[model samples]
Target chain A: MAHDIDTLSGTEVSRTSMPEEKRSDHALIEATKSGDEAAFGEIMDRYRSPITNYLYRFLNDYEEAVDLAQETFVRVYFAIDRYHTQFAFSTYIYRIATNLAISEIRRRKRRRLMSLTGLFQSEEDTQVEFQPPDTRKLQDTELVEDERSQIIARAIAALPEKYRIPVILRDIEGRSYDEIAEIMQLGLGTTKSRINRGRGLLKEKLQHYL
Target chain B: MSDEDLQNNEPVSRLLGELKHVEAPSDFDFGVRARIAAGRPAEKGGFRIPVWLAYGAPLALVLAVGGYFALNSFYSVGDANVPVVALNEKANVAAPIPAPSREVVSAPPVTKPDDQLVVKKPDVVSDSNVVAVKKPIAKDKNAGGGSIDLASRVGRRFHATPQIPAKTVLDLIGAKGSFEADGWRVQSTTPNSLAERSQIQTGDVIESVNGQTVTDKSTLRSNTPLKTVRVRRDGKSVDIVIKN
Candidate 1:
């Protein structure tokens, strides 16, 4: 319900005036550690949208983003006792999400290589099952917007991983440069340079949009 | 903020910021709670050996080790089957004589008279069948009256004979085999040579050159013009004069 407001405005809205919303992330984690499950739910509510949006932009695949986002929360839930408050909770969660996304990317590359080798395999060796295809209709304007969004997503995905991550955190997710540096375990200067480089790359790829 | 901060607020950054933000699906909370309830799925695909390899590798290693020991034991038994005769090399004995399927017994060293050579057979320790050769040529003058012992080569399989010492004089004279304690034991004579033409046969021992005793080191005799050669064949002395 809270996420709908943020989605409609295309910006982060203020938290609702609920008792859990007013509690700091550390306070909520403390509560969860003290056997308060609702506190953990509130923490998820706070991070779920941002983390999902971050992962979706990074992967350019909605299903994978949602899966990774859920996994990130699951990790946080299980490892709550180990979560240190030295770094901001946002930095810690983003770091975990980044690592998961990188692993998924590498896995996709391996899968691609295996599929290439499988090209020589006989047709009978491959099991093919029929499934019904999508039959949803799209309006003309919606089709154009969808195509543009796909092109932008492709350009962002095409950037080298070093640049892509920092650029997305700064520009799309509105994470501060210092927070990006802490999440990446890189120097602030290095993080900003990568963000600039990523933007330069995206500019080249999306020249028509610019 | 650094100069990089100014670049961050540029048009491309602005364009990126204007891009539509995505929120988690409505059922995202349900999914997380479900995953928590399920605990974690067993992790997949980290350093997993294939099923075939896990079994096949150890089997191949065991087979390799077993094959090595098998071959080693087989060769050891084969070497044991053949008796190795170690000679008393100090006595200037000839190389081991090949004697198939026969055990050679070594008699005690016989006392020699001042003018005769007493060739003693070396001590024989046989593990199977036995044969005895007492002593060789007690009356041979050329041996300088000292006894030498020899080991017999004993095996069930046909063994390669001891290599004959190369006698340059005998080689030039178209003969093979060594000059023994008694005389030059003629093992073979060259075909169509002077030795063959004179009807010199194998097993014939040349006892003298014109009745003069020649020792094993007799080299100058090869250059001497052929005249008469007395040979002992089958224990009888015979004189054959060469047609020079």
Candidate 2:
């Protein structure tokens, strides 16, 4: 395993420990670009979990996160020939995932607008379809810890997207500020400000916890 | 003051660290493989409709349907100014042109080849308001009185009455509505007018002409036959049928 301390945000960009025989992402992509299924499979195995987890934090909804993550890979697989190796592969894929998440958010908004009248038409419709995820799977932690965790998730989710993306990428995923800036297509100063603003918002929301 | 923020920033860092980590479903890799296998045909730019076209097709379909109906109804202008071609009246003895009331107007039962009769009968529901007239024909001067060959325009909206000469060109534009509200409001009717004969009143609110909701005065076409005229009067709806 190799690691680099990211001074921009003062966090570590930890590389995944790869096997000796493991091919590089760009190499696998090149092979896949030439129609090699095995190479593509190797690429998929390498990044799926991180991409999925990234999306999950961004969306705050597991089902939608997973769907968008899968869509991100599908897009990558289709556009492999166009994947320039000048940029890091992780940054490239994370950019794709971020775009997919933004689109999903927009879609949810449009859906809400389209059927706003339906909300009051039925009492059953008032109830949210995606219940705050079933915490039943977890062992008995303190009620306060579970509640605090949910509050934090909600607070993070509620942050304005400009703040949310940078904050999550920096704080939760431990991504470097430069990568976050590149993934978000924003200037580094702007990215840093957004993360700070997001943390300020979370701090305000979790005032009692602090 | 979290200015030169560290990875450890009060509660935000601790909270993020403690938040649950989610992994891709176990079947995600298999799903990806299956999708790749299924989507292989697309690699060659095979059989897939371009993204723009896929979305555009439905929008185009809706517009096409809307345009067809709009154009069809547009050209199918109802005969608002329908001539009274009374089948039962004698074809020769032209009755005087009539004007009586806003609802139904009929002149005195006077017969003349050229006099316009004016009379009033009932509000609506009356065939007595029809004033039949004969179209005068001039026999050919070269031939005898028993000859044909009376000349006429190519097309005209109103048939020739004994009084007025037939028009040559089609007046594409007709009279606009006098007033319009929810639909068109009947401002006034000519004495023995087509609208008056159809039992429409000055105060009647014309809701929809034919089946379409009336927008403004521009939508009224005198050439098209009035199939169904729904009107709102004194808080009640009344439908008038004007047959040619």
Q: What is the DockQ of candidate 1?
A: 0.30
Identify the runs in model 2 with alpha carbons over 4 angstroms from their true place: A1-19, A117-145, B1-10, B40-96, B99-244
Q: For residues A49-140, could you state the per-residue lDDT of candidate 2 as single tens digits?
A: 88887887777776667767777888898888789998889899999888877766655543443454532444343232222233333232
C-alpha lDDT of candidate 1 relative to the true structure: 0.62
Error of 2 at B113 (Å): 52
Q: What is the interface RMSD of each candidate, in Å?
A: 3.6, 4.3
lDDT of each structure?
0.62, 0.56
Compared with the true structure, model 2 gives a TM-score of 0.49
- Candidate 1 structure quality by residue, lDDT tens digits, B100-158: 43324454546656644333433232233222222232244222111111222222222
**Residue pairs of candidate 1 with colliding backbone atoms:** B103-B131
Best by DockQ: 1
Model 1 alpha-carbon drift over 4 Å, by segment: A1-21, A117-145, B1-9, B41-244
Model 2 DockQ reads 0.28
DockQ, every prediction = 0.30, 0.28
